[model samples]
Structure formats: structure tokens, C-alpha cells
Target chain A: MKYVDEFRDPVLAKSLIKQINILVEQIDFAKERPIQLMEFCGGHTHTIFRYGIEQLLPKCIELVHGPGCPVCVLPMGRVDDCVSLAERPEVIFTTFGDAMRVPGSKKSLLQAKADGADVRMVYSPLDALQLAHKYKDREVIFFALGFETTMPSTALTVLQAEADGLENFSLFCNHITTVPTIKAILDSPGMQLDGFVAPGHVSMVVGEQPFHFVCEKYKKPIVITGFEPLDILQSIWLLIKQIAEKRCIVENQYARVVQPDGNFPGLDAISRVFELREFFEWRGLGSIDHSGVRMKDDYARFDAERKFPVPNVRIADPKSCQCGEVLKGVIKPWQCKVFGSQCTPETPMGALMVSSEGACAAYYNFGNLPELMALKAEREKEEALS
Target chain B: MTASVPGMRKRSGVLRAETINMSHGGGGKAMRDLIEDVFIGAFDNNELSMLEDQARIELSTLTALGDRLALTTDSYVVDPIFFNGGDIGKLAVCGTVNDLAVGGAVPLYLTCGMIIEEGLSVADLRIIVASMKAAADAAGVKIVTGDTKVVDRGAADKVFINTAGVGVISKAHKISAHNAKPGDVVLINGYIGDHGAAIVGARGDLAIENDIQSDCQPLNKLIQSLLQACPNVHCMRDATRGGVGSVLNEFAVSSGVCFKLRETSIPVRTEVRGMCEILGLDPLYLANEGKVVVVLPKADAEAALAAMKSNQYGVNSAIIGEVTDAPTDTVILQTSFGGERIVDMLVGDQLPRIC
Candidate 1:
């Protein structure tokens, strides 16, 4: 609690809130419409809701939860591929605990596990490699999924496997890049984002240079933010000050961890094992160019997609889901048609409702449910009449 | 040929197998040997020693304690059968005892049932049985009757335990979840989330090293003292699987009042907090083995706190929150930060977040 408690000081948070309030008043554009800031990482969104930071902020500032949670953005067809891989008798499928619950076209990995597949939850890809070493006879497939924050570790894990010449281990690589997704969001129609709070962990791996485009091209202020309540509050204050002074620049609020040039060894590992895919399908957002990474041809033997027969089919999102608008900051999660009625944490219908890091899940879990439900009812009645 | 006959030899059984097999559950000599040497050897009480199909108690004994009987049962399937503070056996005994105690009952007797996998070591079985006996003795409860079964290696975990307890509730105590009112205060016995954190550490999947131990103790003594000081306790529940959060939610819904908890007043160990932070888990929702949530009138809050603090298991007890009149049937938390949020019931298991 040493580092954590310091970041959550109530006194400091109050002062930061006061500063944010003062800055919002100085900005002339705030009188007309609320200034919207997007926290791109799902981790930051979790922090915002966990500490009730959104409630403490002034009404003039709005925080938009972005599509940074890897599990939430995983397309259904990829989940089906994971399920199919897990169901094979000769293979043992390992994945992060949260990914097990993501629904596929047929069934989730949890359901497949319940139906007698050898599915296991692991904290790291190395744990999957350990299983490969222990079993030796059966194939061990690690469902490697995450943004650049997790990519380095998985890449290093692949390097370890190769060094040890472990034959039974392979990766179902679904690693994604962060910059291109941000670009896609910037290019989105009706985009009204004022500033950006970039993911700290992802920034740690891939330096501040990658985020310069947001300021250079899009003319937006971006802060590489940490996933603590104080860090988030301070980042918001920084963004507000940038807006008040009419400046656009990339800044680092989490200077303690994220290096300006980024982690060299980790970036080296990522480039060594993975290459950018031409396009990758997001769960709610459609295919974005160069948004995903796959194991390079040199590591083809270590790729589960190549070693095993994957269905490799594309499945469309559900008809009722409005996760795209939620991700783009166009509408609040509760404003979605199926938010609480047809979609919930227990039986999620959209990607945003799946992971706790997802905007909808965060709202459902921490927000006042009765109020949201009442709002949903009002909206339904209005829709019925109109 | 009856063993009760004078000068008749008592046939004591002996077990030679090192590991459990199907024969241990076949209702044969091996099974009898296991029961006699492991269970009966440790849980040595007059009622259990009688070796009858049912444990018989005197009607007068039951009548003397209270006007009504309380019965509760719980199953223990913890992944690691053994943990830092307790094992599945101790958990089985204390879990059922606490269940009865929270109902303002004087816990008296317990029945244990075990389903073991084929490859479980006999030595491990002996240790587990001894742990159960030790827990029951400390709680002043008798393990009166039990059963055991063995299955194939892949059919079950290494071991699973089920305990059903019986106690007598005094006629004077009228504790119920619906008894809470607006002016009631919320109290917790001690530090929570220790047992949950210990289990996560013991599992070793995350490789996080910590000195946290499970707070897995019988709370009957603490409950007895608490009820003695505040006989008109409004509601009581052990925060087991879902920690204090789930219990508070149940209290709010049943009493139709709001329970506003101050985050700073809640006692959570630094180690548990750190672990939760690293794993993206909420300590409020973590499981506790020996913690209890007590709701009572504001006037009796001090006496109740004093009584709880005097008990062995309640030294760190504190009044964490108070009941509110409006926002009916909701649980809110005044966060450590100067903010508030709704603490809703968890839909399913709290999965670790992908950082």
C-alpha cells in the first residue's frame, strides 16, 4: 500500500478537483458545451469508476471510456476459434481468467471447459509454457491477447520457448497495436473528443514518440496517464490546463514508470517475434488497418494458428449492440438500447458488457443500477411512442 | 455375539493402505478401518463412540438450552485442501459452526461427510480428520456422525468436506435480517479478506509472495459474548464467500434500508489490500472465513463493540458504518477518496483483470 496509498490521498484529490474546477471555468468553450476527455485504456476507466472520480469531477468535464480493454474488443469469431482450439483432446488451452467468459458464436471457453475440455486460467504466458514442459505429450496453446502493455511479456515468453526448444508450446497470438486504433478513432465521423488520456502501461512499452501524431496531426492534447485515482485526476487537470491555454501537446503524467523513449528491450522482443497484420477485426469496431499483430513467418512453428486447424471465420456483431458509439464517446453506455434490458454482466450481449474494464460493465457494476434502469425504462417508453 | 455383551472382545479395525482406493468406500473392512482409525480416533466423544447409525441426545438436554433448534450445513471444496491458517477439515467444522452462531444459536453438534479422490494419501486424510476434531473441540461442539466416499482419480478433487451443524437458539433472542431499522449501526469483528488473500497466495498461480494467513476460526464464542451484551441484535451474518459486501447487500434488501459504509473504518490488512490492488480485485468482495457483519440499534452499538472486542476473535472489531433511511434497499460506500459509489451484489465470480 505504500505506492498505492500515496496516490489515493483524499486531501490531494480534493485540491486537484479544485484546480480542475478552476481550469474548466477559464476555458471559454466550456460555457457552450462540456469538454469531453477520453481515457483510452480500460484500466483508467476502471480507476475512474472504482474511486468514484467521475462523480467528483465538475459537470463541465466529461470522461469517455475508450476501447482499450483487450478482452472487450475481442471479436466473437476469435473467441470461437479459441473455443475450438480448447475443445481438441490433444491440446490444453490456457488464457487469462477474464477471457474465459467472453461468449463465442457457439460457446465460451468456460462452457467448453465445463463440457470436459482441458481449459486452464493462467496469469502469464510463461505459465502456459510451464504446462507445456510438464505435460510434454500434449500441445499447450496460450491465448496470447492484449495490447502492447502485454505484448512484450508474451514475446519474451516466445523467445524463452524457442531458446529452450520447447516443441509442445505455441501461441494463439492476438496482440494488438495501440496507435492505429487511436488513429481509427480520430478518423471516426462525428468525433468530438477534446483531449486524450493515453494508457500508461502501453506507453511504457512503446514510448511517447508513437503518440505525437495525436498532437501533430489531430491537434489534441494527450497525456500518458497512470491507473491510480490521483494519477487520473491529475491527468484530467493537465488536460484542462492545456485546453485553457489553447495548447496541444503530448505529456507524461506517469513519469515515474513510463520512460520518454520507452523500454528498449521489451520493444526489441516484440519486434523480434511479431509483425503487424494488414487488418484485424475489433469486436464492436469493424476491421482497422494494421491494428493487430501475428507471429512472424520465422516463428511459424510456434504459432498455434499455423500448427493447428483454426476455423478462421469472421462472425458479425449482434444486431442490437451499440458498442461502437459507446467506444467513440458518441453516447453513454446506459443510452445503448440493450444496456440493462438485454445485456448485463451475467449475460452480456455486447463486447462492452463483457469485461469489467469495459465501459458498460464498469457502469453496471459501480453506477446506481436503479437510476440506470429507470432511465432505460423512460427511453423505452419514448421510443415506443415516437 | 454382540460387542455390548460382557467379556466380549471389541473388534477394533486397522488400516494398512497408504492411499485411499475404492475399497475404502465399499462398506467393507477397509472402510470400517478408515472410519475407526481416522475419524473416531480423533473425534472421541461419547455420542460418536456409541457407533450407532444415529447420534442420540437426551430430550431434556435439548429442552434445557433453548426453545427452538437451529440446523445448518456447508460444503468445503477449496482447491488447496491445506492453507496457512487452516485446512478443509477445520474450514468444514468452523463454517457450519459460524452459520449456526450467526443465527444467535448455541452451537452443539456437527456431522461431517467427506468425498475423497482415489489417490489421496492416507496420511493426508489422518491430518485432515485431526484438524476437524481440533476445531470442533475448540468450539465445544461434538462431531456426532459422519460418512465418507471415494471416487476415481479424475472424478473429484483431492478431498471435499461437508459439515451439518445443530444448535439451540435461546427464546430471548429475536435476531433476523428484517429487524434492522434506520438508526441501526453496522459492525465487523476484525480484519477481512485475509482468508481470501491466503487462498490466492496458496494457489501460487500469480506467484505473489505474502505473509497473509487465513482468518479461519470459529466465531461462536465471539457471537455468544456479543449477544449477551446486546440481546436485541437486529441482524447478523458471517461474511464468507462474498465477504462483507454481499452480506450488506442482503441486509439492505431484507431490511429495506440503506447501509452506508465508510471505507476508512473497514479493517483490511495492508498485504491483502496490496494483493487486491495488484490483481485488480476489490477487498470488499473478497471472502473471509471468520468475519461477521452485525447490525444493531445505535444505542447498543458501544456495548456491542465492547463485548466483541473482549472476545478472542474480535479484538480488532470496529463500527464500520450506519444505516440510512432513504435510498431504500441499497448499499453505498463513502470511499477513502472524497467520493461515493454503489456496492452492488456480484453477478458471478470476481475474475482477475488483464492489466
Candidate 2:
């Protein structure tokens, strides 16, 4: 608790909040209109939503969610591959719980599980190793997912499986790097990003180098922040300062755990097992070149994609869902038509509603259905007034 | 030549290779026979032999306090065997003891049962046992009895712990979900989701390095201090399996009142929030090992907050919400945008294998 508790000083947080409020009020009233800031990390977006940080800010400032969630950006074709692997009899599909509910082709991993595919929810890639050892007769394929923060673990699992001489396990690697995704977001048409709240966990592994592209090329202020309320608040305060001064650079607010170099051991393992794919299809972003990692040639024998026969299922997002615009910071969770009505955490229509890091899901969980609530409230008021 | 008795027929060389298989949880003669032959044999105690789903215990007549006590039982199943903050052993004991403590009980004794998988290193087992001993000693509670069983290697994970604790409750300590009243203030001990995040980070799965450790500890002393400082405390509940939201829902239903929470008031660690966001999880629904949700009368709310802050475990404690009169038997959240939302009970599993 020594290193952990110090970051959450209530007294310091209060003073900082006071300073931020005063600063917000003092900004040029007529010179600048709404100061639009985009937080590129899904984690920061959720913190901003969960802690109600946006509601605390002045009306002159508008915060937008960026294309940061790896799962939301993942395309339908890759999910089809995982679903096909789940259909195989000799395989046991292991994945994070969020991926289980994400719709693939005609069904999801959860649907596949219900249909008698040996699907399991694992907390880590190590648990996948345990499953492989337990079911030695069958194949255990991990549906590897996530950004730089989770890729190293899948890489380690592969290396450890090879070292242990376990042939029944494989990785269906969908590991994507962070830098390219950020570039894709910024380069996209009509991209309006003033600054970014860089992901803390990803920065811990990639360590501020990959994000340099955003600073040098785009001139967008980027603040790598931790996931706490104070961390997000502090990062926002930093971002606002940078924007006000017309300076753009990568600043690290989470210095305690994340170093400039990052943890070398994890990176070494990742470099050993994975190689960058030239072009990979992201669900919303189409195909971003050099955006994702696939199993290296040496590990192909353990790769489920090679072992299993899966049709290259090219699918499109539901015509109504504006996930692309949502991910790119052009729209908010409340702006989505499927936010609380047709698409919810219980019955998700897209990956955005399924993952906990998904902006739509977080907003729904914390109650962003103001229109519905207001309607009910007005009815009650009218009944009393009459 | 030495003559061997039937009981001594199996020697070190003749011992069967140990492995955990699924039959251990099958609820058949294989489980019972294994329990009696291996587990009971190793443990060898009278309390375990009673063989009831519920434990029945008697207080020491020497310090008989004339009042009935509170009882709580908890089960722990964390993966990777160990973590950065603490291991399964420490979590098992602290979890159960904290439950009884927040229920306004003076934790006195505990009973533990271990379901250990075959092929687990004996050295690892020893470390866990030592951790349990240390945590119990720190809490001033005795592990009077315990049970141990080794299953086939595939049958169980490394180890799973189930601990039930008994504590003496004073008559003055009138606290339960049913006791919450309108105008009562809701408070949390500190930040939520630290234990869940630490366990996840310890797995080395996310590739993110977090200095975050599990906030797993005993809160009996803290609860006792709060009780003494403010006897008018209406309700108390530990934020455990379903986090703060679940506990608040329980209070609302039991007290037949509505509840409202402030979005800006809740405390959460940045590292945890980051992990939760990346993983698509909600801190409101994530588990906490040492956090609690309490409702107290407005008159004693300040006193209760001061008392909680006096303890090391409750340093970041703050009044987050209050009991309300609308939507009886439901819990609502007051969004920072001046909107109202329902904070419902946990449906199914949120985060599993996270103790």
C-alpha cells in the first residue's frame, strides 16, 4: 500500500481540482470556442465516464472517446476464424470472458460453448497452459486478444509451452500493437484530436516510443496516465496545460510503475514469439497495415489458424451501429442508436457493447440513458402537477 | 527380514504418484473415501469429524459475554497459486474474518478446509500455511481446526480454500442490511478493485507492470473502532464478491428503501481503473477483498467517518451516498450530470477466480 496509497491523496486532489476549476474559468472566453480533447485510450475514456470527470469540467471543454479499445477495433473476419476454431471437436477454446460474448458470424464463443464446444474463460494465458496439460489428449487453443499490454503474456505462454514440450497447445494470436492503431486513428478522414490520454498499461510495455509518432507527426499533446480518477484528472490537467501553451509531446504522469525502457523481460518474450503482419483487418477501421502480430514460423505448428480450416468470412458491421464514428471520437456512447435499447451489456449487438473497456458498455453500466430517465421523471412530475 | 503390518504396507517407494483428477468433486464414495483416508488422516481433529455442511461451535465459558454472535463463511479460489500482494492463504482467512468484523462481530475462531491438487510442490503448501498462520496471528484469531484433501492433479487447480469464522457480537452492535433507514449516509472504507487488479497483474497476462498489490487484510479492529465511536450506525456490509453495488442493493431490499450514490464520491485506484477499462470491466462490479459499504445515521455520520479514518485500513474512507425514500426496495445512483440511475445487483459472474 506504500506506493499505491500515496497517489490517492485526497487533500492534494482537492487542491488540484480547485486549481483546474479556476484555470478553466480563466481561459480566454471569446478567443477559443469549445476546446475539444480526445482521450485515445479506452481505459481513460472509461475512467472519465465512471468518475464523472466530464460532468465536472466546464461547458467550454468537450472530451471525446478515441479509437483505443483493441476489441472494438477488431474486424469480423478474425472473429470468424476464432469461431471456426471453437467449432472443431479436438480443440478447447480459451479466451477472456469479454470475447466470449462478442458476436462472430452466426454465433459467439458463448453460443459455441452452449453448442458443446469446449470453450473456457481463462484469466491469463498461464491458465491456458494448465488446460493444455490437463487435457493432453486434445488441443487447447487460446483465442489471444488485446493490445500491447496483453500481447506479452500470450508470447510468454507460447515460449513456455515450447520449453515445456507441450504439443497440444496453440495460440490464435490476434495481438495488435498500439502505435499503428493510434496512427490509423489520427490519419483517418476528418480526425479532430487536440490531445490524447495514452493508455497506462500499454505505455508500460511499449514505453513512450511508439507514441512519439503522435507527438512528432501530428503535434497532438499526449499524456500517459494511470487508471485512477486522480490519474485521469491529473492527466487531463496536464493535457489542458499543453494545449493552452501550444506544445505537443509525450508526458508520463504514471512514473512509479512505467519506466522509459519498460520491462525488458516481457518485451523479449514478445519479440521471440510474434512478428508483425503487414495488413490485418480491424472490425471498425478496415485493414491497418503493420497493426497486428501473428505467430512466427517456428510457432506455426502450434498455431490454430494453420491447424484448423476456417473460411475467410468477410462481414460488415450492422448498418445502424455507428461504432466506427464512436471509436474515432466523432460520436459519443449516448450518440449510438444501439446504446441502451437494442444493444446492451446483456444482449450486445457489437464488440463495443460486449467488452468492459468498451465505451458503450461503460456508459450503459453507469447509466447514460438520460432521455429515458427524463421521460419517466416528466411523467411523474405531470402526474403530481395535475 | 522385517514383518510389515497392513497399515504400513505402503512405503516411500511404493507410494502412488500423486495427481489431481475430476472424480474428487464428483460427490461419490471416491470423494468421501478420499476425504476420510487422506484429508482427515492428515488433519486428525474432532471438529472436522462432525461432518456437517454447517459448523457448530461452542464459546469458551471463561469469557462468556451473555450475547449471541455473528458468523460468516467464505471460499477463495485464485489462480497462479500466488500474487504480488498476498496468496490464497492470506486471502481466505482475511476474507472470512473481515466479513464477520463488518457484521459487527469480534472475530474469535476460524475453521479452514483445503482442496489441494496433486503434484503441487510441498514447499508452496508450506508457504501458504505460514501465510495463514501469520494473518490469523495478526487478526488475533485462532485457526482452531482445519481440513486438507489432495485431489488428482487435473481435478483441482493448485489449491482452493474455504474458511468459516465465528465471532462474538455485543448487544449494542445493532447492524444489518435491514437496519438501514432513510437519510442514512453511505460510506466506503477506501478504493475498490485493488485486490482484483493485483491478482490479474500477478498473472503476468496483461504485460502491464502494476505496483498494485491486493488490498487483502483483516478489518475487525477497524469495524470495532467504528462501532464504539458511533453506535447509531444503521447498516454494514463488506464489498466482496460483487463489489459495492451488490452490497448496496442488498441493503436497499432489506431495508425496503431506495439508495443513491454520488459518481464523484467513489474512490478507485488508477492502475485498477486502467486494467478494468482495457479488459472491459466495471469497478462498481469488480470484487474487493478489504473494502466495505456502511450506512449510518446523519447525526453520527461525521463521527463514523472520523472513526474509520483513524484506522490504517480506512484512511481514504468517504461518505459516497445516502438512503432515499423513492423507489423502495431498489438502489439508484445520482450521476454527476444531475441524472438518476439504478445500481442493480450482480447478475451471474463478474470476474471469476478473483478472490
Candidate 3:
């Protein structure tokens, strides 16, 4: 609570909001459109919504929820692969609770579990290893999902498994790097231009250097910000000042937790265990080259994909879902043809709707509650008239 | 509880088994002896002491209490049966009691049925049974009838409890989720997320455990005080499995109204909040065993809050929010930062967001 309490101080939040308002007014570019700032991590998206940071900020600044949620970005094919491996008789599947709901081509892991599979939710990779130790006869496979924020831990877990000579344990690595995904978003055509808020936890591992291209080449101010109410406000203020002063640089607003040089040992651990795949699939966004990481050759003995021999099929995104546009900031979630009318949190048709962190799902679940009430009433009235 | 069984005659055939086996549920002498020694010996009421296949009560007795009967049932399969504050037996009774109480009823009797796993220690079973007796006495209800079964070792968890309860609702009392109107006040009893944090922390695998305990208790006494002070209370519900968020969502959709809850007004202990932060869970969505959501008209809000404050369970009761008519079917939270967002139900269980 010591470190967490200070970051959520309402007093500090108010002062930061005031400073942000002042900076936004000075940087009022043409006053016709608002300044677009994107936070590239789902952790920040969750904090922004949980604390209502977007509502506290001035109307001219908009925070675009980026493609940082690993579950949101994972394609249906990968989930199917996980399910195929999990469905085997002698295998025990383990995954984070968040990924259990992501829909596959056939079904999600939760569905597989309900269908009499041995899928389980574990908080960490180490918990999965413990299950392997407990059940010596069964094969334990961990669905290692997330970006660099979780890469070091999974890498360390695999190392621990090898050191303990645990051969029954393996990893279904879906860990992705943030650099390629960010660059893909930047290169996507027709995105309204503004600064960015880089992911805080990912920066702690990969360092500030991975985000320099967005500022140096794209000439957009990017701040490596923490996921707290006050931290978000201060980072917005920093981005606004940079835009007003015509400066493009990567600043660390969360200097307390993140380092400019990053965690060296964590990066080293990750490199030792993982190697880049030629092409790894994304849910909304199509497959990107060198975007995902797989188990290294040295760690091949601990790879679930190789150990289990799953039917790794490729599945395409649903044509009706506009998640691709939403991820790249091409359109708002409500602009999609099937946002609430056809797609919902309960029966999600798109990958974005599967997880709360996805931009479309967040807007559908959290955005415009009062307005949605009116919308529901109008629809009911229309139904009555019909 | 002084374990002196002075009332019920002791069955001379007390079996000698340290742990239960399949024969204990065989409907033979072993089964009866286990029930008499464990349940009937602990409860020791005239109705249960009879040991009849079914409990028989006069119809006039129920008719005299109220015009209608409220019957409710709940099943308890909580892991780590022995938690910091209470066990599964206590939860089994409190859950069914609260279910009946929230319907504007005075709970009268309960029936408990347990499915225990083989190889479970008999000592642990006795402790759990004793706990149920204490809870039933506190709620002023009788555990009139019960049953038990033993399954193979891997077939069931240590123990699973199912409770069915009957209560009488007076003709004058009217409580429903659809009864809430605009300008109504929302109130909650005590701190939220104690039960959820306690269970998750008690798991001990997360390594984020603290001194948090479950807030599991019977709410019949608290409900009685609220109805006495403000008979026009719109709605009452215990925030159970999905916590306050799930119950509030049901209220909004059922009544076709919206709610604006003040986040700061919702009382939660510091430790629970810290544990939630560590696990990336929202306390509003966490489970609470001893908390209830009370909604009443603005005119009766003050009296209801005063009555709740006088009771043991509702001592920390506070008015947390207000009902609105515009945002129908939406529950919004006025965040501590003076901003608002919709509090939507999680698609599945609440999972942590990766940074």
C-alpha cells in the first residue's frame, strides 16, 4: 500500500488535472478537433476506466485504448491450438484467468474445460510447474500469454523447470514484443496524428529505447507512463507540453518503477529462452512479421507446441467485426455495424469484445451508459410501434 | 458451545472410525449413529430430536406468522472449508437465511443436507456441524431436518452443504428488485470484499495473504431492524457470489432504472482494498457474505440508515448511492476522482489485466 496509495492520491490528481487543462488550452491546435493520445497498454486502459481518468481530463484530449492486452491481440488460431493441446487425455492445461475467455475458432478454454478437459487457471507459470511436480504421471503445459511484462517470469519459470529436471512441464509460448505491434499501429493508414503514452510495465523490461522510433522518426511525443490516476494525468500534461513546444521525445513519467536502460537480467533471461517467430498471428490485426516470440532451440524440450503436437490451424477474423479499425484508431467502437446490436460481452463475435481490455469491449461495456439507456428505450419504442 | 448432550439419549452404538468410509452413508446403523452423534447431538431441538423421516409442523403456525411463505435454497462448495472468519457450515446456514430475509420474511426453519467425501476426518466433520448449530441459534431459526452421504475419496471435495429454508412474509411487507424508483437511496451494510479477499488470500498460493477475514454472518436480525424502521424499503439483497456489482445490475435491469454510486461512500477496509489492488480485482465485484444492498425512498432513507446503524451487522452501514430514472438498465459509479463509468458485469470471472 505504501507505493500504491501515493500514486492514487486524489489531491495530487486534482493538481495534475488542472495543470493538464492549462497545457491543453495552450496546445489547442485549430480548436476544430481534439488532441489524440494513445496509451499502448491495456493496464493503462483499465486504470483510465477504473479511476475515470478520461472523464477527469479536458475534452480536447482523447485516450485511445491500444493493442496492449495480449488476450485481445491473440488470434483464434492460437486459442484453438491451445484447446487442441488441452483436449488431450494425458495433458493438463494451465493459463491465466484472463485468457480463459478468449474465443477460439471452435471454443474458448473455458468451453473446453466444461467439455471435460483438464484445463485449469493458474496465477503464475510457477503454479503450473507445481502441478507438474504434484502429478508426476501427467504432462503439464502452461499457456504463456502476454507481452514483455510477463516474458521475464515465464522465461525464469522455464529455467527453473530445466534446473529441477522437470521434463513433464512445457510452455505454449504466445509472448509478444511491443515494438513491432507499436510500429504496425503507426504504419497503419489514416490514423489521426498525436502523441502516445507508452506501456509502463513493458518499458520496465525492454527499457525506453524500444519506443524511441515513435518520437525520432514519427515525430510524436511518447511518454512511458505508469498506470495510476495521478500518473496518467501527469503523463497527459507532459505530452501536452511537448506538443505545444514542438518537441518529440520519449519521457519517463513513471521513473520510480521503470528505468531508461530497463531491467538487464530480465531481458537477458527472455532472450535466453525465446526466439522471434517468422510470423505470429494477432486477433484484430492480421499476422505481423517478427511480432511474436517462441521458445528458443535450446529450450525446445520445454515447448508445449512441439511436445504436444497440436493441430495448429489458421483461422481468419470474422468479416463483420471492425476490430482492426478500432485497434488502429481508424474508427470508434460505436461506429461499427455490429457493436452492441449484434456483438456483446456475453456473446462476443470479435476478439475485441472477448476481453474487457480491448477497445471495442471497453467502449461497449463502460462507454455512454446514460446515452445507452436512451438508446435502449428508443429501440423498445420502435419494437412496440412495429 | 459447551458440548454436553443432556437432552438427546445417546445411541449406544457409536462407531469407531477416525475417518469416514463408504459404509457410513449405507443407511444402516452406522449412518444413524453418525447423524445422532454429530448433528442431532449438536442441534438437540425437539423437532430434530424426534429423528423422523420428515419434519411435521402445523399449517396454522405458518398462517399465524404471515399470509405467504418464502422458501429459498442455496448450495455451498467454498474451497478451504475453514477460513479465517467462518467455515462452510456457517456459510450454508447464513446463505439460506439471508436469501429468505431479503424477501421481507422472518426465517423460521431450515433443512441441511451434506455430501461428504470419504476419508474426511471425523473430528473436522464434528467441528463443522457444531458451527452450523451455533449459526442457526444466532439467526433464531431451527435446523429441523437433514441428510448426509459419503462418496469415494476423489468423487467429492472434503464436504459440500445444501440448505433449504422457509420463512413467512407478512401481507404488508412488499420487497422486490422492481420496486425501486427514482430518487431512492442505496445503502450497504459494513465493508465489502471481506469474504472474497479472505478466500483468495486464504488459498496461500498467491503469497499476497494478509489478516483479512470473511464477513460471513446471518442477516435476519439486521433485516428485522430495517423493516421495523422503514417498512417501505424498496429492495433488499445480500451481495453474495458476484458481490455488490451483480446484485446492483440485477436491480437496474429489473426495475428499468439506473444507479449513480459514490465510490468513496462504499465502505471497504484498507487491507481488503490493498489485496484487491494486488490481485487486480475490483472490490465492488468481490464477494461478501455479511453485506446486503438496501434501497429505500428518500423520505425513509434516514430512518433506515439509523436502524441499520443500531444493529450489530450494519454498524458500518452508510448511504452509498442514489437511483436515477434516465440511465435505465445501467449502473454507473461516481469514481473517487469525480468521474463516472459504467460498472458492467465481467464476461467471466474477474481476471487481471496484463500491463
Candidate 3 clashes between residue pairs 3 or more apart in a chain or in different chains: none
For every model shown, the clashing-pair count is 0, 18, 0
DockQ each: 0.69, 0.09, 0.58
| Model 1 agreement with the true structure over A225-246: per-residue lDDT tens digits | 9988999999999999999999
Candidate 1: global Cα-lDDT?
Answer: 0.93
Off by over 4 Å in 3: A28-30, A370-386, B1-13
TM-score of each: 0.96, 0.63, 0.96
Q: Candidate 2 lDDT, tens digit per residue, A1-386? A: 35534555556666767666666655574147666777767777666665556665666777777667776766777777888888889988998776777777688778888999889888788999999999999999998888888888888888889989999999888888788888888889987677788888888987877788788989989988897778877887888787777789999998976888877888898888889999888776678989888888989987888877878777988888887778777777767766666887777776677665677776666544344456447666978999
Residue A232 lDDT in candidate 1: 95
Q: On DockQ, who's better, 2 or 3?
A: 3
Mind giving the per-residue lDDT tens digits that candidate 1 earns over B1-355?
Answer: 5647744335677788999999999998899999998889889999998989999999789889999999998999998999889999999999999999999999999999999999899999999999998999899999999989999998899999889999999998988888889989999999989999999989887899887999999999999999999998999999999889999999999989999999999999988998998888899999999999999999999999999999999999999999998677788898999788888888778888988
Query: Clash pairs of candidate 1?
Result: none
Off by over 4 Å in 1: A368-386, B1-9
Sequence-dependent TM-score of model 2: 0.63
DockQ for candidate 2:
0.09
- Model 3, A153-259: lDDT tens per residue? 99999999999999899999999989998888888888776989988999999999988999888999999998888888888889998998889999999999998
lDDT of 3 by residue, B129-197 (tens): 999999999999999999999999889999999999999998878999998899999999989999999
